[model samples]
Structures are given as C-alpha cells and as structure tokens.
Target chain A: MSARAETLPATGLRLPRLGLPSLDALGAWTLALIWIAPLVFAAWAAFHSPRDALAFDITAPWTLDNFAAAWVAAPWLRYFFNTMMLVTTILAGQLVLCTLAGYAFARFAFPGREVLFYLVLLQLFILPEVLIVENYVIVSRLGLFDTILGIGAPYMASAFGIFLLRQAFKQVPKELEEAARVEGCGWLGVLWRVYIPAAKPVYLAYALVSVATHWNNFLWPLVVTNSTTTRPLTVGLSLFAAPESGVNIAVISAATLMSIAPLLVAFLIFQRQFLQAFLRAGIR
Target chain B: MSDTDSLDRRRMALYGWMLLAPALILLTTFAFLPTVTTVWQSLFSRGTARRPAEFIGAENYQYLFDDPVFWQVATNNLIYAGVTIPVSIVIALGMALWANGHLPGRGFIRAAYFTPTMLPMIAAANLWLFFYTPSIGLIDRIAGLFGIGATNWLGQPETALWAIIIVTIWKEAGFFMIFYLAALQTIPPDLREAAVIEGASRWTYTRRIVLPLLMPTTLFVMINAMINSVKLIDHLFILTKGGPNNASKLLLYWIWETAFSYFDRPTAAALTVMVLAVLGLVAVFQFRGLEKRIHYR
Candidate 1:
C-alpha cells in the first residue's frame, strides 16, 4: 500500500537521478573496503619492517626480511608437503568411496537400501568435529595417531560427497546404462563407462570443496598430529604465531601470507570456478 | 523360475552391499561408532593409577554442571551464535542485494568480500591478532587520531567476545553472500519488473517479492552458520585462547581444553554429547523444515 506514496512523485522537490544508485554503490564499496582491510593490512605488514608496519607509514621502504625470518623459523616446506598429502589423500578416498556408495544408492535395488542411505545421511549431523574425543581415541587405538592418515581418515567417507554424487548419478538417463549393459558389460563396467562420465561436474565441485575444507582444517589435525612431521600449514602457522613463541607481528604476517598464498593464488586465477563450485555445493 | 528370480535378487543385494561396504565401514569407524562410544565414555569416571575406571553414570555430567567455567563457556557460545548467525546473514543479504544489482566495481567488490572465505580461519585469526593487540594495534593507531586511548579489544573480559564476534562476521558474511547471490540469480527477473511496474519502491519490492523467494536460501545458510558456530573455534587459539580468565571461551574450545589440555576425557565426552544433542535438534529441524520448503518452482 505504501507503494502509492513512493510512486506518486507528487512532491514538488525533485531529487537528482544520480542520488540513490550512487548511495548504493557507496555503501557496497564501503563494506567491501572494510571487509578487505585486514587482508590488505596483513600484506602491508608482511612487506614492511615491524615498526613501519605498525605505524601504517605509506612512505615506509618495503623489505623481504620478514619473509626470510619466517621461512627460517619453521619447517614450512614440510608443512606444505604434509598439507598437500593430506588434501590429496582425502580427496582420493572420498572419490572412490562416495562414487561407489553413490552409484549403489542411485541404481541398485536392494534390501535395507533406504536404511543404509539414512545412515549415511546421519554422518552429516554426527560430524567428526563434534565427536573429536572419541575419534582421537579411535585414531590412537588404530595406531594411526600422529599420522596424516589419521587426520584424513574421518573425512574420507563424506556424506555430502555421497549425497551430491547420488543426486548427479540419478539424473543420468537409464538408456545410457542400458546401452552399455547390452554390450555384456557388468555393473562396474556400466558405472565406469556411463555413470562416471555423466557425473564428472559433480565430482569436480565436490573436490574443490573438499580440498578447500581439509586445507583449512585445524583442530582435528592439531589433536592427532603432535610433531612437525605431520602438521599441516594451518597447525604449523598457529604454532609459529603462538604467543609463547614470541614471534614478531611482521614475521607472523609473512608466515601467514606464505601459508595461504597457494590457495589464495589458485582462488584468484580460477575465481569463476571457485565461486561456481561453492554455489554448486551450497545450493545442495 | 521363482527359485532363479530369488537367487538373482540375492546376488543383486550382495553386490549392492559390497559397493556400499567401504563407505559404511569408514562411516561406522569414524562417525556412527564414535557417536555411540562418546556417549558411553561420558558416563565413566576418569581412571588413574590408583583406581580402575568405573561407570559413574551422570557423575561426570554433574561435575560439568557444577563447574562455573562450563556455564560461562556455554553462555559465551550462545552469545557467539546469537550474534554471528543473524549479523552475518543480514550483512550477506545486503551484500548480495548490492553485488547482484547495477553497481560499478562489482567484480572487485565481490572478490574483496570473498577473499576472506578462501583464507584459513587460523590465518584470518592471525591477521586479526595484530588488529586486536593493545596499544600498538590497528584499532589503537586509528583511535589515536580521535584522542581516544588504546583499548584492549581482546585482552579484557568485556570486549574480548565482541572482538571475536566481529572477526567471525567478517569471515562469514562474504561466504554466506555467495549463497544469497546464487539464490538471487535463481530469482526470475520478471518478478522485479512486475513489482516496479506495479509502482512498488525498491524496499517494497525486496520485502514483497524477493525476501520470500530467498527464504529457502536463508534457511540453508542459517543451518550452516549454526553448525559453524559449533565448529569454528580456530580463532580462539590465536586471538584469545579462551583467556583473560575464560571470558571468550566457546563450547568447542572448552571441549578441546577439557580433552587435550586438562586431560579429562570423560568431561570432554560429556561436553561433546551436549554439542551433539544441539546438532541433532538442528538436524531434525533441517530435514523437516528444509525438505518441505525447498521445493521451489
């Protein structure tokens, strides 16, 4: 009903056409700046001397000493290797496990199928994060504690991955599977030939999400891995920046930037794909 | 013929189970079995060299309830969730409306917003650690311009939780905006045209046509944010360590402390059970509420 008052335009005062849209743009840019200021400041601090960094001195001479100091302080290369191994191992496991389980749920007719699917879905709620205490115990009991495998094991059989694949697989035409089966193909062959190709996009989306997630995962890995041998960049960076370590802010910024640089660069380069993958994952 | 059919059915069932076996085993090992064992472990007393562990049903829970730190942490978590979820969602909604609109520098704005989501929470926390440091920090440097003294944002009990809340909002709003943006794209453009043609103001258009359409997305984001409030405690390690006397301590942080730092497994298990109970309630709401409302045309 108030639309009438807004639409009337009956008031004698005429505002500039540029007024409202410019106001909106102003608001957007402000929020964007505030949102990004911390990161920008971190980049600034990483490049400048510690005193100059805190001073916010625009004329300060840029230097690389902080990066050098940070690099020498920790075994960052080993941490990167561990993180890479952890991400790759988890993705590979999720791919194999979710694909098989998803195909079974999508195509197979079996007893207790619904029950099994619900059980898989239950994992969505009973996440490893919440059950950390027992998961730690289980990891220790299985003699995998302090290993990358222990860090990666709980996340490998992801319900979200399975659910996404099942949805993707179910959308494939039955005729395609029938065509493959007519060539005397077994179930495995049909899945390999027909189903996997059809669900490739879903796999890509799930992989992007899984990689980003495990790369940033901290608490479980922190609990499971005690030494530099198994620490991911995240846990490693946390330790490097710990208050007890007494690392200077500038050096911590450098280490922080270096640790996130790979993902950040990948995100910038494949910005479209990253956003699309998040959208694809989020909507489901 | 019937005998052959039954045999074939059995073979198919067996094959299906084999395909599902790997995932089920992992899920059982990690998710299902642990959930049961966490509950079971919570009912026991901590065993020391002098005594073997025995089932002290409800005693650990009693201890948790009696501990004032538990209550403080729980309350802190509630405030954290209560503040972060709606604030981030609202900011995200505003961001989505702007980015999805006819704004200049839209791509740069969107990128600036989303870059935080790509950073690890620990990295974000590290960056903010400098911002929140007393006296020589960013906030103090800026406040100096206004003749205001350096305030200890993360060092004091009063403002420490609020400081953490601000960082959480910054990290999350942009991520949540992606969902809102996706939802906005799916909103048919013709509806906006119709609303404008009907003499509706921009605000009216959003309230009448857009917000209702975005309800499912909002619900989805709300559920994710709720889960995140429970899980996203990485900042506590860097920013506060639940410190200044447990002022900013959250539930998950406390659980980690109880389990790892304090070496009290039973108490930690009890806290985990409580978190699980909260999550379970959310799960039911999501399945029931989301499943029905998500059938958008």
Candidate 2:
C-alpha cells in the first residue's frame, strides 16, 4: 500500500509495473530454493565425510568414500538392471496393447465399442495398487510371483496410454487412412504406416510418463519381489536405508542419490521434452 | 455391391474386436477380475491350517468398523487427503503463475520445483530422513542457530503425520503445477490487457480473469491428488513405517501391514473393498465433471 501510494502521488495512476513485481520475484526464488533444499542437502552430505556432514562444515573437503561405502553396502547394479527391465517391459506391452485398442476405438465401428471404452476408462480409477491383494494372489496363481513380469503385468494395459493414443489417432485426417486403404493396405498395415507415425509424439509422451512412474514405483515391487535379483532400486533403497540397517547418514544419502541418479540425469538432459511431454499428457 | 458392403462391415467389426482383445484380456485379468475377487474375498474369513476359510458376510467389515487402528488409519488418511490436496493445488497455482510470469531465471526455478517429481518416493523419504533426524539434522541445526533445542520430527506421534504431510506436499505440488501451467498458457493475454485497460489491479485481473479459467485443471489435479493420496505411500515404508503408535499410518499402509506382514488377507481384502468404493465414487464424480468440462469447451 505504501509503495502504491508513493508511486501514484504525481498522476494518481500507478501502473502494475511499479507495484510489487520485485517482491513477487523474491518470493518465487525463495520458494524455489526451499523446493530444492533437500536435494542440495543430500548432495552436500553425500559428498562429505560423515563427521563433516554432521558438522555443517562448508569448507570440508569432498570425498568419494561415502559412495564407495554405499556401493559395497548393496547390489544397486542388479536393482538398476531390474528397474530398467521392468520399465522397458511395461512400455513395450503398453505401446502394443494401447495402440491396438486405441486404433480400434478410433477407426472401427463395432457393436459394444462404447461399453468397452467405458470399461477401459474404469481401470483408470480401479488401479492396481488398490487391488494389490487379489493381484498378488493372481500373480501367484499364474506362477509369475517374484518375477519382474509379475511386477509389470498389472500395469501393462495402461488406461491413460490407451486414452492418449485414442485422442491422437482420432485427430488423424480420414483422407490419410483412406489413401492407405486405396494402396491396398489392411487395418494393421494402415495403422503401422499412418496412425503410428502420426502418433509418435504421443508415444514419446506416454513412454516418458510410464518410465518415470514404474521407475519410481515401490509398493507393488516391494510386495512382489523377494530377492535382490528382482528388487528394483526403490525396494532395494528402502531396505538399504531402513532404520534397522544401521547405515550412517552420509552413506544413506549417497545410496539414495545414486538410486535416483539415472532418472534424474535423463530428466535433466531431456528437460524440455520431459516438461512438454508431461504438459501434453496432462492436457489430455 | 450391397452384399459385398455387408461382408466388409462384418469383417471390420470382427477386426475391431480382435484389435481390442489383448488389452481387454489384460485389463480383465488384472483390473476387472481383481476387483470382483477383492470384493468376494472380503466376505470370507481368513483361512488357516486347521480351518478352511468360510463365508462370514459383513463380518470383516464389521471388524474393521470395530478396530481402533483401522479408525485411526482411516482418519490419518482423511487428514492426509484433506490437507495435501488443497494445499498442494494452491501452491501449485502460485508456482504456475510465478513460473509462467516474467520472473528471472524462471526456467531454473521451475526445474527446481519439478526435480522432486522425477525422484523416487523412497529416495525422497531418505533425503527428508536426514533433515528430520533429531539434533544433528538440518532443521534442528538451523533451529540451534536460533538457540532452540532439538526436536524429533518423525519420532513423535504428534509431529510424525505433519512431517509426512510436508514431504507429500513438497513432492506433489510441483507435479500439480505443470497442469496449472499448461492451463495458464491457454488463457489469452488479451484478457489481461483488457482488464488492465479497465483499470483493474493485478490482483483483480488475476482473481477475475485467471482463476475461473483454470477450474477444469484444478478439478483434474484434484482427482490426481486424491488417487495419489491413496497410492503414494512408499515414503511411509521408509520414514515412519506408520510408527510411533500408528500416528502416520495410512489406510493403504495398514492394508499392506495386514495382508503381507500379518498374513491376514481377508481383512486386507475388506479394507481394499472400502478403498475401491471410495475410488468408484471419485470415478463417477470425475466422469460427470469431465463431461461438463467438455461441454464448456
């Protein structure tokens, strides 16, 4: 109010520019710093000796000892391999299944199509996590329990992916599909030749979202997998950093940061695509 | 020609069903069948070596109603949703506005806010575990600078849930911000200019012109947040294990504890049925609300 009054004293008309933009900037930066503080603190502790980490010694020399200790403390390499496999498997299955279903919904006129679409959409709310008990039993019955496939199976038929691809395919001009059909292409050939190419951006967006989701996923994997060979980074890290493990703070920090390093680096490198992908996915 | 066209139509319908088969199969096996099985299983009693499971209609749910831990966990989850959803959405709106505006280093600020979303929840909980560690933790160290004594943030019942709540908000608000930012970009700059031309203050322009346009995105983010509150409990495994007398325990976490840890599948199934009921309500609400949004568009 004081700033406004002072700025308006001459002509009694203060434009928005002279008001509190700078203060708003300050608030934004402050919140940003607070948002990033945990990561910064984790980096600080992970790079320093345990005593130095606890001491808040800004001048302390950074070392790799914590990383070394954390490395030896767990089978993170195997966990990483499991997570990569899990994410890729889910993406592969989702792409095939969603594209086929989405193409059907978009281009084909079939009895009960509306009912089937609504049924698929219902899966969006009745997610795998809520049905963990029965899913666990089902995986066990299929003899898939304790495997990566077991962890990935429930999520392979992604409702969001199907929905997004359906939207993408619907936007394709009828002329393109008709032209492909004129060339004597069957449904599969036309879908492969035209709709799939047109929906590449949607594929990337769905892939990014799916990989991030499954990579960070913990609960289902934690319940399904028993050994280090199948446990993803999240489950491994949880056990590694569990209070019962008695690991030190710096080492735990090192392990935690290492677990997220791959996804974090990919996100940083493709930051624009990541943001755009999420934006596109959300707006859908 | 009519006969051939009829043949083609039948063929097309057949191809469509074939195309949908794989997805429908997987969805039924995982989603639809599990839903029915969960409800059915909830009605039966937990089986044992000496006693085969028997149907005990409404007994498991009745037991859940009588269990104090169940009540506490349900209440904690409600508080979790009640606080995290609105608080994150409001912060997300502020973030979207600031990030979308002319703030310097806006890219870096936006990235900073979103980096956590890329992180695994367990990793996030591990990072917070350090700060919430008593005395030597960062929060206490900072408080120490102010001559304040140490406090156990996660070890006590009173602060444990609130501590968990803060992590949830920090982890979620940034993700929600992306939706708001997307919605914000779609708003025409001409509206703002016209408002300014009418002598509207910045606050007035934002309140009148900006917010109402973002309602659909708000509802979208709210549904996402609601689903997240139910599913995103990986941090609980790391931070509290719903510890210090079950203060921070959420329904899903308790369900996990019952089914896996205690091997009481019947009770867990009952709890899941309740969660399913809640999500069903959300689905109906969302579909209806989304239909209205589409109508508006």
Q: Specify the highest-lDDT model's number.
A: 2
Candidate 2 local lDDT, residue B5: 95
Top candidate, metric TM-score = 2
| All candidates: interface RMSD | 4.4, 4.2
> How does model 2 score on DockQ?
0.55
Cα lDDT, all candidates? 0.90, 0.91
Evaluated at residue B144, the lDDT of candidate 1 is 85
Please give, for residues A63-181, the per-residue lDDT of candidate 1 as tens digits.
99999999999999999999999999999999999999999999888989987887788788887988889999999999999999999999999999999999999999999989998
Per-prediction DockQ comes to 0.53, 0.55
| TM-score of chain B as predicted in candidate 2 | 0.97
- lDDT by residue (tens digit), candidate 2, B203-238: 787788789998889889999999999988989988
The residue pairs found clashing in candidate 2 are none
Q: What TM-score would candidate 1 get against the native?
A: 0.96
The C-alpha stretches of model 2 lying farther than 4 A from their native spots are: A1-21, B294-297
Minimum summed lDDT over a 10-residue window in model 1 chain A is located at A7-16
* Tens digit per residue, CA lDDT, model 2, A73-122: 89989999999999999999999999999999999998999889888999
**Model 1: runs farther than 4 Å from truth?**
A1-21, B1-5, B290-297
